[model samples]
Target: MTSGPASSPITDELLVGALELERTDRGVLPHRLPAWARAQCFGGQAEGAQLAMAEAQPAGVRLALRTAATTVELDVVRTRKLYRGVPPRPDGVYDLLIDGKLAAQATATGGDAIHIDMSTGESHVERGPAATLTFTDLPAGEKDVELWLPHNEQAELVDLRADAPVAPVPRTGRRVWLHHGSSISQGSNAASASATWPAVAAASADVDLLNLGYSGAMMLDPFVARIFRDTPADALSLEIGINIVNGDTMRTRTFTPAVHGFLDTIREGHPTTPLSVVSPLYCPIHEDTPGPGTFDVEALREGRIRFTATGDPAEAKAGRLTLTVIRDALRRIVEQRSTHDPNLFYVDGLDLYGPADHDELPLPDALHPDDESHRRIGQRFAQRAFTA
Candidate 1:
């Protein structure tokens, strides 16, 4: 199916990304979750706003090719959602990597955007259809190039073309870092595709990245554990806590066993893989207060969207989950497990984003970090967790 344009001399290569593609009339959608997990969504067993968001954003996915093409273009359908009170998100950016180094970047504009009224919980399409992204000029050689799709929006790969014939780049055989987490790790509000913290950290650590950061879907799902068990990985990290707090998913009692079960499943395949259990980043909204975060009503009325903690602070005593509560529990769990597991480790997420850093780079929407913060986080994580 990928056979270039009628007038072009070079061939087209659309099957460059990791996931299998599902074609629609307009374009092709990428799938990170495997068939079983997707079946959960399709069969109405896990239909919710969370899965809707997770499956859309190509958080850690990218397209790779080894070619001498001077110019490359991708026909893209960018799906952007605008919360009623929030500013319209910037156009999705495509980051290019050449020879395993950041080479160039571009944005996909004038694509289909969806305006969603968060207050009303309703959505409608904004006319602007799909657009083509073209990166031109010359770097004439058989260099390996990877195009990272935007991490924040839904992008349909309409088409891909280059000035020369292209083929899938051979794997570098570098250690694959498999990471799972919530929206922060999912690159929520991240500046661009390759700039997400995990992407940055992975590049800095010189590891092949397999990002499983499913927006709001990082709630210790057994199916995701299955993915971890089956997928090949050299190292693993679980950014735990934030989603549990904000989603108010479970209390300490339930959370403890869930963590054990999740880890046990992954260890089934990666018995000795270096597994790092990460605690939550510092967030004032849920530092001591339990969550079930809600939007700030007054801010929403003023054409702005911000999150506020709703759960009571005292609820922590009753085993309600909070950032502090979850962190402590996670540490204890890792400590206990490490007694029998030599490769297991723990990295405090606060070490990457603590109170001091929070004062310097606060979460913009009272939830997700902005671009500068993402850079700080990626840098700190690389320095702290991946040190020799």
Candidate 2:
């Protein structure tokens, strides 16, 4: 790498110098390699690029990131065999470090999740990798920084930077966003952790994200709200509806009280933070439907599959919950809470994944969205909810 003044942001120029396989007493120069890099005979994976700034300096270096994008750049050799099995899903854990301290971390997974048709012999690059974790407001002082990769897989390092770190833009004071949701928020099938919607929202809005999206277990629990209460946040979002509906976790009477209790617990600590209660997006299966259970016996007998009984059309309309119910519940909650705290907010889940999007971007499994859907959701959020 180009060793210059020690106090510069590690930039693309510096990365170019360190591209070769250099021998060092501490093993090899490129320690980790992604599968694609290995096939190309490039033995080292570019974990990531980082910038170190002085924490105690007079002019404290503020890193203002307009975007945290992750793209896969590779030169695949025809002779190499692409690894099989479900490609890793993105999970935001790839961290950016400054002075041995974590400045920011992004998580991503390789393979098909990023819409890469690896089955065909085509070079793929998934843009806008997700941000899993981020540490901001570094104290101005010189610090050595590095990228901490989540997995040891190999890939070449390309555009990395630190010198001339982008300065933070002036705005209202930072907002801590604490969110709780389901698999979609948990990163699902995204390429890496940073590509997830929550991560995307956090980076775009310039805020902290404490994601509590349980993959298969999003039961509206008092414990979960307790967790939210303990964490410090300036704003909070509860993406409810879908998980409860999909899991068929509770009855209408139970659902109402559970939601109320959950919010009550969160308010114990964050009584004044701007809170937004969101319902489920537009889902035909559960839009006006209710659930107790349903199953596809034909598919099951063929050893193909099974289904849940909760989504029957008539039953859903009768005793089960619908997006409308959630909307009403949220409206009531906000109305009641607004009487005491006027900062409460409500967003319809349909706003995120409405009926219009369904026509163009159908959920691959009739449940979770495809990669395209994820991108659309993130973009919509950036446009509407995140602008504030």
Candidate 3:
């Protein structure tokens, strides 16, 4: 949805900008998060630019911000300046206005102090959103506040105002979610991101999203995990498979254990958080295949490849890796973990992205999904996976 200034009594706008102080091209910029940094899936940094701007603003001024919910955090740095009030209490909530409209209000509280080294030195503080702050009163005097953020090569400002808050509605905690995935759940180019089974399911159910998909990167690394862990989400979903099969990240002996370990790490803090684990979508590449992945660098570089060269049914029988293997792993995980963690659930990834989607939305790269596919997948995730 388009977010900017609101229409009503408040006319003044607070202008905030951010610029990088160092020479690195990867620092955070005002209003915009670093692309590479986002790719890393690290928390705290997502909204570093926006929070930096908020910190610099004077107390009692309303602020509007535009970005993903996961980007907000509280960590002070000399490089990042605050207007007044000796840094906000870790538990304090800051009103977040996006172009005169309130997008989300957040606060971070109750955590062991961690020291962050900026241009200054080590400082102890808690980071991450502790809770969502709600404002019932508005500050008097200046109707708005502007924040300037500087990082690396760019600088920009964001304006906020208390006079005009987005039209307030009853406190219904409804939320729309955006999600992304890889071939494992894309049905290997599952129809489209918007309709990638997940999108279809989400749409049939109703949801929202901004899907960023890369077919090869669904390895349960810290990056992808951070994306889900940090984002303000009511429900989250993950389809695991394909990459492990196609790239052959591990052996069958190691695959099951790896999956278990990955889930364990995520549940570290999100104990009661709702989660859905999806097995592989349908793909003929490893219908019954198993073992290590075959490599052909020359063909890969030429951008021409096939799932496997042997096409040997014997490989399937030998227990390499297949959809069944993934499904079994997921079931085992749910059965064992569900006793203690009631919120954890499982889904068949193929339900969203499957062979049928292939015919409807052909795979452009035979591996990674195209933009259209990303949308389809995102929409589906919002619907099926996100629904409580």
Report backbone clashes per prediction: 1, 53, 47
TM-score of each: 0.91, 0.56, 0.47
Ranking by lDDT, best first?
Answer: 1, 2, 3
Give candidate 2's error at residue 368 in angstroms: 1.2
> Candidate 2: where are CA atoms >4 Å away?
1-174, 292-310
**After aligning candidate 2 to the native by TM-score, how far in Å is the CA of 173 from where it should be?**
7.4
Candidate 1 local Cα displacement, residue 254, angstroms: 0.6
User: Per-residue lDDT of 54-82 in model 3, one digit per residue for the tens?
Assistant: 32222212222322222222222222222
Better of 1 and 2 by lDDT: 1
**Which 10-residue span in candidate 2 carries the lowest summed lDDT?**
50-59
Show where candidate 1 strays beyond 4 Å.
1-17, 45-47, 115-128
Q: What Cα-based lDDT does every candidate model obtain?
A: 0.81, 0.51, 0.44
